[model samples]
Target: MGDDLNNDEGQLPRRDLLKSAGVALLAGAAASAGAAAAQTSASAPAPAPAARSGKAVGARLQGVQHFGLTVQNMDRAFEFYTEVLGGNEVMRDGDFRGEKIHNTLLTDQEIVARERGVNPRTIGVPDLKDGGQRLDVRFVQFDNVVIELLQYRDAQQPMGSGDSWAEPRDHMSPAYPRSMHICFYIRDDVDFNTFIRDLEAESARRGMTQVKANRVITVTSEQERQAAPLDANTNRITEGKSNGWSLIYCKGPEGEQLEFVQALGPVKKTFEDAMAARRRMLAAAGG
Candidate 1:
């Protein structure tokens, strides 16, 4: 989640004595690519057409690099993401701690409170004992994005304390402030209902019993009809009147909220047109 360590070095072994050698590699290649794109956009000629069309002018970012989730168990989370969801395991690291890590993670609240002559507990800041806050992380890559699974260990809350929820809570509702959910865009060729049904069955077989897929909701063009429930195994869509989009909500192993969305009919066409316009804009900008 920290950006400061984009190029952290790791040790590699030799073929013979197993001597460790430092190798340079990207810790967050996607973030680095986004930064490069932002730099290029910032250097473009003043008042480009894209900027002129907007009211506010500033640096433009490419898009999201990854989503980070704190999980109760690293191994279980990895299995669900990679085995069940078909994500590729790209990287894994553990025991991330130290002063640099603390500062980068913004967990050095106690140090700041001490310097400012304030009680750390008064501000609800966890005491950073021994500066030994650590995190075990695994990166899983899917077709379009990556999800970073993290298990944190610190003096305030040790590892295996079971802080990550195993069940949903009231505050976790999407209506609550700061609540968020991960949404996956379904492929055009895939049947939305069939995908959800198969996903639920496979996830259960993989030991993610906590993962539950909700009923399919058809968001139609009719203003009076909203969230019409449809069978998860049946297709009940009308192309003209009731084909705006279809979606479903679910929960992951750690009670993380998840969503699957597929745009249909006019909505799909609008999305395609917007994508085409984006390509033309990028071409005109010499990107």
Candidate 2:
């Protein structure tokens, strides 16, 4: 799935991974509390509630429950997210002996076979010695956002770059539309420049690959909207003003593109909206 984890489907991925002995402190505690409640309730027989006229189960989607990305190195990925990036480790699950990836869920059989080993069951063997592919996953929380970082273990093939699959080093390839990235909002209290400088310093000290200490830019549409044409036709052009301090981008472990963004200043948003905002930010930040 490249760094994208590429499971753009609405359903959350099944967490069949074996859990680590020391799961994330906070989320673990929360889960344990919930488990304790369930156990206590189990001891006493409680009557099943009658169905109501209210909305059905899992109906009313709140929005963006969580997203995940596949990583090659577990420790490095954890370090960058929890330590360097300053997010809390929610929980860790790992050392799974079996994982199920079916053609029914994902259309690409080739990706399934390569990323996840062949399903021995499909071959008529219910139990195989190899135990299919192994997986280790951890969840990280950034306030409202939750992210799952999973590593595919015991696989013969490499993940290669999912985003770059269509074109070398290309972040966006229509071939893999499921390919995605996550961004973090910089707190208003923090100085954007200082945060960026520290990130650059840390990246350099750690010798991070695919780091872009550039492309940090500011954007504002305060003045009349300006257009930059890709060709002669205005349809192909990117429109917006690159002014007011805005956002920056960088790559995290597993080649996942992460971002730090400042709240947009008052300006008329162009049709491109967030896309135009990003362009203005990058150009203003001067990468």
TM-score of each: 0.62, 0.50
Model 1 lDDT at residue 211: 80
Candidate lDDT scores, in order, read 0.57, 0.46
* RMSD to true structure for each model, in Å: 13.1, 15.3
Clashes of 1: 0
Against the correct fold, how does model 1 do in TM-score? 0.62
Candidate 2, lDDT over the whole model: 0.46
lDDT value, candidate 1, whole model: 0.57
- Kindly report which residue stretches of model 2 are placed more than 4 angstroms away from their true locations once superposed: 1-59, 99-132, 155-176, 216-245, 264-287
Give the per-residue lDDT of model 1 (tens digit) for 1-287.
Answer: 10111111221111111011001012233344554477678984455667655633322434456899877766777777766565678888766666666566655676778888998655544323344455778898765567899876554554544453222254566777788888766554556665665566566666777787665444345332223332543334557644667677788887789886766687666655665565455444433
